[model samples]
Target: MSNIIETKVCSEIGDIEGVILHTPGSEVENMTPGNAERALYSDILNLSVAEQEYKQLKQVLNKITKTFEVKDLLTEILEINEVKESLVNNICKSENVKPIKSSLLSLESGELARQLIEGVPLNKTTLTGFLSDERNALRPLHNFFFTRDASMSVYDHVLIGKMANKVRERESMVMEAIFNHSSKIKSKTLNPSSSKHHKDEITIEGGDVLVAREDILVIGTGLRTTTQGIDFIIKKIKKNKGKHSIVVQQLPSKPESFIHLDMVFTLLDRDKCMVYDPIIMQPNKYQTILISIDNGKVKKIEKQSNLVDCLRDLGMPLEPVYCGGKKDIWIQEREQWHSGANFFAVGPGKVIGYARNVYTLEEMNSNGFEIIDAQSVVDGKIQLSDYEKYVIAINGSELARGGGGARCMTMPIRRKKVDW
Candidate 1:
């Protein structure tokens, strides 16, 4: 396939045709204990180890379909003088470092792309800069490896994330610029911040939103995404002339592990979904609401029993697959923390996840998904076409520590429409 691709994702478990990835680079290793918390990480990661693990994912996806790296795409767009100026201006103005705009634009596209992801060293020429404790004038995007959080493709449009944390706002801006300026990709973008309904409380991350079907969306509201953020999506749906259903699942805000919906739930196949038992299956204070829209207006709004049941009622029944098996909640909690439930579907019934989550992999295996090592596929020792249902397991001892799984590390740009 050519590099020119149109962005379209009508379902969560569709066969992926094209995806965007960011291999963990100097940006990830640039963090220290002092700034780990600000970077949304519980602990600092070893770049070498993380890169080794990430290679499995990249190679497997490359074997299956077209894969575009974030750095490559950014570099391609930066080659255009107008786009280079506009993007540099946006980043500098947004970060309140307008003084460096001219310097940034002076660099070549490749070097400029490197500095945007990696940190640009603080120019200590100013007395205040010399006195500051900060290491980088524009902090490195430490969480950029988790490409799913910044922006997402919904149907034919890309919804630019209104990141909950200010530290990650640049990721969204970069993504918006890619979609708007990249000649290789064709799609429109919907930015919540650019809309009239934008507010401080309205924040939406890609990890919190799932496209269940062409007209159905399953979204989670918690710390990273707010009720107001879902409302912003609702407003956008209202403008379209068709019936749409949205399942709003409320997530707990206490544990940082529950920061996004993908941490506890993900679509694995046309008839199946992976879920954490405690929060998604068992009874709890968290509420699930169903909102129905028709002809540009909300037709009905009601509380749902749960996510699975809500989708079942909407004609998309999905059998729930336990993240850590159905036997013990203790094991479930341990595995869920490592993103056991986060599975990225390359095709219907074909998915990828962390190999460290043994119990979760066991549960998936028992449910008919053959456990295949990602390295085996990368080495040409195995072919995915030989299995009807399979999960490619990638080494994740280090990547999981970064608080995401295969699904979180990927952003699908184009998917083959599923034959429902």
Candidate 2:
């Protein structure tokens, strides 16, 4: 077995050292059009095409850093009898599938892991089961491929998600179990569910939180994350007793595209950021608030002029790259819907995003970022180190339909601290 993996994430633009990924599997294809909305998907994905597209991301990440698969890690820990029993018990109880406990415990670790994620089919032998319209005794995790949503690593601790949707609650439970029991992972887990201040409305998803720097956290509050959720995060920081800053951007509730902070804004480097102009830059009903915490207390709380201005005031001046381009608002709206602003930084000035956003890529090119195809890097035709600043564009035609981009799909566990 590999040595226990300690978690650490101090910056968004640092060189990634370790990351967790879940390749699209049957769990993704398990959903039907009827349940797509509940699954939080705008459209159903073609499994074959999605897998092909995902391979580009997986292969690119594999070449760059140490990558771990959730299933493999889950199976590794499930091999421990005590951990296995406790995890299964917790899952069955939390998910209201206690009837399957003995059966789950009876299976081998590998098979059990598969069933847990892909779902266990309902027997339908009993009268209640036969009469019920349910398809599985346990629901398949349809959105597991977007690993960034369930749990997030922030400066050595894993924050287990308190999901906004009941359907995704199991994903958090599964992730918490992995971080808690996986022999390969060594990290303290903070679960809002266990928090004394937690309430039904206090839900926070990983997609809404960004570790911009060791002492700075940029968060979004909207449909997915509530004020109470942000409050829980504030309490956590206060307990730590240090100078901490958080820039809270209020997101729109109407468009499903504005689901998280990363959807509209993401840090690309120590001095660069990508933003959708309408909400982030332009004056709107949604406000940006900055809160400063020092010496275990909130030193100041006030409304900020805007996300960009507030960030600059925090001493992290960033040059903004418009999502689609600076010319047209129409194109910006279209491309932002397709996740044009969502870029995942593997290192400062080194990132990955979709190539479909031609105008956005052009803007990046104008900003001196070399555009490289992910396939070229994967095939060894071009070395990534050859370019100091580059964007490896992956084909996200199919994956983008899943309503996320490179940043939304990744959950970076450990990153080398940036020399700011």
lDDT of each: 0.93, 0.91
Model 2 segments more than 4 A misplaced: 1-3
RMSD of each: 1.0, 1.3
lDDT of 2 by residue, 228-333 (tens): 9999999889887669998999999979999999999999888889999999999999999999999889989899989999989888999999999999999999
lDDT of 1 by residue, 98-184 (tens): 988888989999999999999799998889999999989989999999999899999999999999999999999899999998888
Model 1 local distance difference test score? 0.93
How does candidate 1 fare on TM-score?
0.98
Q: How do all models score by TM-score?
A: 0.98, 0.98
